[model samples]
Target: MSLGTRPAANAAERADNGAMVLPGRSHLRAQRAVKIGSLAFLILALSAATLLLGRYTVTIPDFFHIVAGADIPGASFIVMENRIPRVLIGILVGGAFGAAGAVFQTMLRNPLASPDIIGISYGASASAVFAIAFLGASGLALSGFAMAGALAVALAIYVISRRGSVAGYRLILVGIGFSAVLQAVVSFLLTRTDINVATDALAWLNGSLNSSNWDRVTVLSMALAVLAPAVVVLSRPLRGLELGDDAAAGLGVNVERSRLALIVTGVLLAAVATAAAGPVAFIAFLSGPIARRLLGGYRPLGTAALVGMVIVLAGDFAGANLIPGVSLPVGVITGVLGAPFLLWLLATANRSGQGG
Candidate 1:
């Protein structure tokens, strides 16, 4: 048995022999359950409010009436055409980013290893911007190009980092370097583009939900439908791999194969979110850490996904309504919020001597 469980076993054995046992273990599990349940409820409640709290203001009655096929004129159009698709897409993108971030962080055993920070999102952004500025790509074509770029970047980083074995810090360093280069490329492309194309590209790079619609929703939905299940199935191997390479190998996990699967899966999830929502700022980076804290550092993927959904939807709401006659992109709010968090993380890491 592991060091962590040995004491628990002793305590339980003593309790079985009529001695008093510590209650912290069960209490901790119960507390985690409560936290997870509470966060899930909060996400659902926020999503409902998102659908109802826009300028048009669909009342609860109206929302239910529309859901039940009553078709209440303007309310129905707003709900069906605008608000529903936006909210659904937000949830999908948030969940994808959140889950992908969690997987990356857990697999790498480093909180700073999320796709957004590690150049994957920048890869997608650069490719999308190039497609827009040079090839006049739009819609699904842009998304496909984005995914291809993300995958290529991720593969290149992996190849560079693998010197016998892929070290987490090595991967991160390579990713950061590539990310800066890609950003410069995007900027150069933007500067050379026509005004109208530049405007469209800039807005997309800012990562807004202004263009959310049914078609984008369908694409994200289809991606999640296939990839989410793969993630869930792979999570077991991931848990095994977390116990170190030798231990995972002892548990019959092919270490290199598992790592490759995880990398590909994570890249796809992050790429799809970037394609649909333009790299919605720090949702991927922030969501995993926040979810870990809330789940008491257990790496609860589902809870992380919910936290992501809440962040994006709530951030979108705040961006739109927090100021009069001014609307910010969802990414702007997240970037602003994430900067301080990143600083705090670095400060804490320094203090703890982790040097992340």
Candidate 2:
């Protein structure tokens, strides 16, 4: 073949390859959309069911009427004041935990970097336990203590891990160490406290929606309103950082600044959620990975949030009714569900020599 003909043929071949790649990309995007839509539908269905199906079942018509401001005797108070707040707080706190987990896992590029696995949740739990046992804090004051504790732990982790740049392995190691110490602190406090206070603290630590109320819902809503936007904005820099610090810097990202912002934002998200509903077990640790799997390894923060809501709402329902006579904490159900997955993940990682 002539040289000129060869060049034209190669150009045609490149065009054909590009055409093939476009369709694959488009197909993947369509699949992702479908998966995300399905997740949203599941969340809605779970929320509705949670509201309707319980010891005192409310009919659909009655639920709508109650929502429409009708006073339908017992149903009105049960649906409006009790069930509604529980559902709302579940959704809000679940989303917060999911988003926080996604940020930590993605930013650090480590699956074990979850707030609960590290010291953040332990921090919140320990602080709140201390407040309950000694200071006799309750309501908003207890929540405030939780938030402060999470932030303090996060700050300490950052300072300890920051040498030149924050290494993911170093951060995770430091956090795990902190987690052990804080867990010990929590246990000691529970032992030293009065039995009544210890019982209350234990319930909170187990993560229940039993105390869900309009006040808790409102606080969580306000915190997410401010923090969610920060997460969206920082996500761009987060993506860059995923490509490594030098590469992100080359891409015009302020690596240290962006990382710090992300850390603070993630800590606050996890903190508020823990404050509102306690550290509801593996929701944060599990949500991101679940969403990513559904999206074929593409992590969408929003999808993670929705998956979190579904897990919480569904878990809460099952926890309440799974045993005929006894209601369990939502965290207990989640812990049971998530433990197997965690073991599977560890096994898979070990087989691939990534468990270290």
Candidate 3:
């Protein structure tokens, strides 16, 4: 009605549109800092606990020296020879799976689109099992099989996901179907193999750290050292993806290209992890949500990965020592712990009329 009212309206509109640097940024940074600190401390703590909590325990000072390259009769050997490699492998592989799972879920816009459910881990498991049983392979050769198998599984999932068009629901449904087929192949291969070979395959399938040596650590460390940096570089595009496909593309996000790149990155990360740790179970599926809850926030791939490393190492160690009679496989332990959460998710989905 009046010129003064027009100016006030315009000013109000501008204020709403303006970037005033919300307090959330500082909070996010604080969360980032906290997560980073937690990761570092957790790594140290897990390493120390792994070394010191064994049958032949060591004191704090002796454990420190043992890690710092001093010689103690049994302490040095255990720390250097046994604990360090295992801890390192757990951290690297766990982090990769967590990060990969986070990125994949964000891209697919579905919390259930993780590698474990979508046949990626099954792919690697099938391939690695075959290699171990048939070729009598161990060590680094198994790593190659795992990586190839995981990537192949990823490719198959992608093709199926893209069968008609790129619908999130369709991709997830197809992925479930693919996982069934992969599991059957894995089962058949184990049945046909020799007993000893089957034993080896079974050990790998269970995802134990009992056999984790320096060689496996070396393979995973190298993969993670490279892949982590790539993830950081792609963070911008990945963040854009959380806004949904249409919005992301409208922001010049190169939707298809970004999705493809992220999927490739995620598949490689999971494959490398599988190669190193044999699909240690639930880390990929559970890490992101757990990390989100821990931070009291949402998905941040790097933070999620760090949280993943902590969860896996902690779970693995706990499983080994927490119960005396059963030194369970890390995979079995995690699966047991994560089953309730998975059930909760299923119940929530059904209540919402969302198909599994």
Best of the candidates, lDDT: 2
Q: What is the TM-score of each candidate against the true structure?
A: 0.92, 0.97, 0.90
- Top candidate by TM-score: 2
After TM-score superposition, what is the CA distance of residue 167 in candidate 2 from its true location, in Å? 0.5
Number of colliding residue pairs in model 3: 0
Q: Candidate 2 on 58-99: residue-level lDDT in tens?
A: 999988988988999899999988999999999998899999
Q: Which residues of candidate 2, in runs, are more than 4 Å off?
A: none
Rank list by lDDT = 2, 1, 3
What root-mean-square deviation over C-alphas does model 1 reach? Answer: 4.5
Off by over 4 Å in 3: 1-36, 163-165, 352-356
Score residue 313 of candidate 1 by CA lDDT: 90
State residue 128's C-alpha deviation in candidate 2, in Å. 0.5
RMSD versus native structure for model 2 = 1.2
Better of 1 and 3 by TM-score: 1
Q: Write the per-residue lDDT of candidate 1 for residues 1-356, one digit (tens) a residue.
A: 89999999998888776533446667788999898888778778878887898677888988998988997879898898888898888899999999999888888888889999999999999999999999999999999999999999999999999987787889999999999999999999999999999999999999988889999999999999999999998877888777777888899999888998999999999999999999999898999899888877787788889889989998888898889779889999999999999999999999999946
Q: State the weakest 10-residue window (summed lDDT) of model 2.
A: 347-356
- Model 2: pairs clashing at backbone N, Cα or C within 3 Å: none
